[model samples]
Target: MTTLRRPEIGSTPEPLDLSFPAMPDRLGEVRRQLREWLSRCGIGADRAYDVVLAVSEACSNSVEHGYRHGGGLVRLSGVVTATQLLIKVTDHGEWKSRDEPSDPRRGRGLQLMAALVSDAVVTSDADGTEVEFRIPLDPRLSS
Candidate 1:
């Protein structure tokens, strides 16, 4: 279940947290909602679009491959500050490696996210997989 939070802007950035079941159908709505949030945070259209793509890809990977059986939780937490947009997507399930195939598009989400965000980190352990992205805030870049 996802929590409803009213993210606040102040001297210190207030983080917004949300969680949902690892279901394919829900990823799109969450991604769209996050993109809208980025815009509301004063991010540029291009940047927000890139963010949305990266986040969507990460979330998709979690929902589709994070567990071997049964569903788990996919959590998203974000904080928008005057100088940066920090976002994290975490899944509380076993991480499984994707088998290689002929198609190049099957396993390029991490690469794309690294290209889009200023800084990103992906870690997986026995507990879960966590992907964090930090995008530098540029005031004049917003549309």
Candidate 2:
């Protein structure tokens, strides 16, 4: 389990940094820890939900698509400023191209992420794939 440092109210919290094995079972733990960290940072439940959902999709993508043969690591990190929250989910696996045929019912993770956040970007290379999300903060929460 990853330990998160609680932040003082009305102050920018320390950047969130967590790394775990890229396995399906670990996602629940990741979501739990992330929710706790966001709550401690004073993020409202509604906004926190959006962040959590988006990040979860990214992690799911890393686990499902990033690693095709064996297990790897997924790193989830974030920073909160007065204006917005920035998050990155990274996996150390070969990048998978969308040009390849994918499940018809799936592949909407990117779209879901985009709808939930102000900005969502994905980048990949031989080393890995990273999905970054930027979600604007609510005025009341940033104060």
Task: Judging by lDDT against the true structure, name the best candidate.
Answer: 2
Q: What would the TM-score be for candidate 1 when compared with the true structure?
A: 0.80
**Model 2 residue 133 distance off true place after TM-score fit, in angstroms:** 0.9
Residues 1-143, model 2: lDDT tens digits: 11123234567767899999989999999999899879877776776788899899899889888887898899999887766677899998975687888879977889888887758899988789889887665564333
Worst 10 residues of 2 by lDDT: 1-10
Candidate number with greatest TM-score: 2
Taking all chains together, the TM-score of candidate 2 against the true structure is 0.87
Q: Which stretches of candidate 2 lie over 4 Å from their true place?
A: 1-10, 140-143
> Per-residue lDDT tens digits of candidate 1, residues 1-143?
11112223443434668798899888877987797677567565666778888888888888877855888889998987666777999998876665534366567777887877757898998889999987776545433
Could you tell me every candidate's TM-score relative to the true structure?
0.80, 0.87
Model 1: lDDT to the true structure:
0.74
